[model samples]
Target: MAGVLLSAAVACVLLAGAASASSSSPRVFTVGGVERGWRQPAPGEETYNHWATKNRFHVGDFLHFRYDKNDSVLVVTRDDYKRCGADRPVLRLEGGEARFRLERSGFLYFISGSPGHCDAGQRFTLRVMAQRDNGAASPTEAPAMSPGGSFNSTPGSGSGSTRMPPRGNAGDGKTSGAAPFGAYHAVGAALGVGAALLAFAPPLPATISDPPSTAASFPAASPMASRLRLGQPNPNPGLSPSPGERKGEEGEARKPEPRREVTDLGGGSEVVHIPRFMSRETAWEMFEHLDKRIPWTRPTIRVFGRSVVQPRDTCYVADKGLTDLRYSGHQPHAHSWDDFPVLKDILKEVHEALPGSHFNSLLLNRYKGGSDYVSWHADDEPLYGPTPEIASVTFGCEREFLLRKKPTNTKSQAAGESGETARKRLKASAPQQHSFLLKHGSLLVMRGYTQRDWQHAVPKRARAASTRINLTFRRVLP
Candidate 1:
């Protein structure tokens, strides 16, 4: 009897403290992280499924779907999700965009309502766990809503539309979209007491990747995370390249191979493309290594007085001292070149490609598909100084590289950003002056006044399904 009373007292105190603590914020995620939004996953990209594998979802999280007006999103059960059936949908959302909030645990399914869309791989399932599974909540469950998820109405629709299904327990035969807060408090209180009663239950099943801050958190590092970080032994590291494997690679930093001159933008300004900068085998090895190990992130940036996530993932690596790089107010913390062996090898190749080149900074971009792109902009910053030479190496998928002459009358401002800022201001109104297919294992160089007179962009290719990675080597002024 005394032990029961003690546990009860502890439960009440915990419940009170939790009630006083601020509710955790719900996370909003783009359905598949595709820049083109919720549409058909291109040929090689099983977008939503691919994205789901990389992230963990919890109750109260939001999944946003962005598509054309002609397309609609259907919320369905597991059976419906499998057959691509739209006849009986839990919810049908249209008008270009929609956001759905998870209210329970288990697999939630979504599919395109258009006739042929789901058939072409437009459906995806989200495996959501209890809040505690993410190490962000107490073992007790709590009801949550997104910052503005009170409505079941389609978000981007001008006309209010609700897909609220009929409820069996409600008296009015209709249910309001908003949840009652008082009910949650009462339920939480009851759960806290029940939790105390079952004091010695087995531990919760939160993933190892979850942060170790909550009571239910796992104590060990995630196998995937550990391997990605290079902290532990991984049999198939695939990062280190063997000397014998470098059959056609240069013995040391050498001269550029025969190149195709793309264009000459005037005095000393030229863009040239070089194929086979490194052997095909070397390119493959480097791409595979960097793909799994690089700490890639698609950070949000302030653009045109508003904040938006960058379409592609990026990372920075540089030699000792260099000008700090801030891309539209977000800084990708630079990694030491010493940490990545593959980068050191690539740097040696870049040095050979452009003999006497003092390239010290590297900007890496990983495009998941055609949707991930860089807009038109020049790197005419004080950091690069004047007449900077940039060597760009490619691997994985091939993408179209475009360059256009800057408007003659336009004056140059300090456009220090990588490729996102000057996009809207320097929108390319004229046709592209040169369009080159950047092939795998190829190298491209732009020197002299190219930054002063030309702009470049990688536009979205909806049909492109191949993944691409580009390593752009630049000489950041110390």
Candidate 2:
């Protein structure tokens, strides 16, 4: 009893002041504090060091970076920083912009992953002051210029617990996974005193001498709210029954119960986005498996009386018996859902989320990298009936998902319209647009007249340095 009381006293003393620091809102600091973003500074420049000296970094603060498409940010070791390369990084984020959270304390080195950028002085180092700062500590170093944001993610609304996309750039704008640090803290209120003891423990190392000790886990795909996110993890990652076993699926630990948000885009149209529909781990695993297994091909599509290959690779899989299915003047070879066990499990979850959703067809799209994109258009095909609920799941990397309200006059629109006509409508005038950063393991569901009223697109982002796979589940009517 005496020992327990003594432990409690020590814990109380350690935590007495942390209540406010741990709960404080994290600060976001743009790397180098420069206008040119994360490009290399002048030869052997001092701006990065000057910037580091100017900032007061604490754990939980975010480091934001902006850079070019071909460029990348790397979380490197002290040796790598000196040698001008990171063969093994603590983390690597890509895109035009990115944000990273300082999970713990100690020195952190960041450098450019691009060939010569680091040698030319496109890097910085930071020392996260202990989290228990009393406004009287030695000046600290600032974060390096690297982005590949973790989900929980820009330092995202929370997958890497994390983005600065040029993306999640190890900050260029998309997000990554590794948010368990913040994810665990986000639920701190629910955690008991035993967990708070960590506040006094040694801060996590910021140096990248080796790869991160833990695997990167992202909780994304669903918007944060009363929306449809993925199911939560199975209590703990190391519990008796695995998430797949508990849910009767073959996936890894499921994410939090995804949340869904409905948006009314006029014309009686409704669209929903569950940013956290699926956990990043499960979604990433699915992406890896599907990329190699799915028989993907660049189907030739007729555009405005001219034959042209589609911009991205695609595969059509469905629940058997639905022949005569075609899109854009081409009929893709049909595949069965049974071929991929992961698909079957994901489909089951979709059904559970939308009790009445009857989807039998799946269109798998693979965006090899930044260049692969789908031009603007609606999914208003006759085969899908007037109003269809199409559920879209994204895995691996992040991309811009755009939804635009159609022009008031459909004077030039036509059935089976493909190609230049779509561009004309978009270029005629800038239409009202809504953008969603499609993160890994996220779900976007379009129902009601969303397809008919709003045009959706995954536009080209040259700075996007990652591959992406999207699964659109639909119901084909006979």
The digit string of per-residue lDDT tens for model 1 on 1-478 reads 6566656655654554454332244566777664768987554343455456445566455676678888888887656766789998877777877666655445567789899777666776655544422234232332333232333335456224333332321344323232335635654675566456546543333211111111111112344653453223333322223333342343322223445556676767898788767655346545655786678989999888899999899999998777788878788889998777568777876886677898889999999999999998888888898988988999989899888877653226425544655565456444348888888889999989988878888889987697899999999887
Candidate 2 local distance difference test against the native: 0.65
Q: Over 4 Å off in model 2, which ranges? A: 1-256, 410-430
Q: Write the per-residue lDDT of candidate 2 for residues 228-305, one digit (tens) a residue.
A: 221222212223323333332433333245567877777877778888886543454366557756778998998889
Worst 10 residues of 2 by lDDT: 206-215
Please state the error at residue 330 of candidate 1 in Å: 1.6
lDDT accuracy of residue 253 in candidate 2: 30
* CA lDDT, every model vs. true structure: 0.65, 0.65
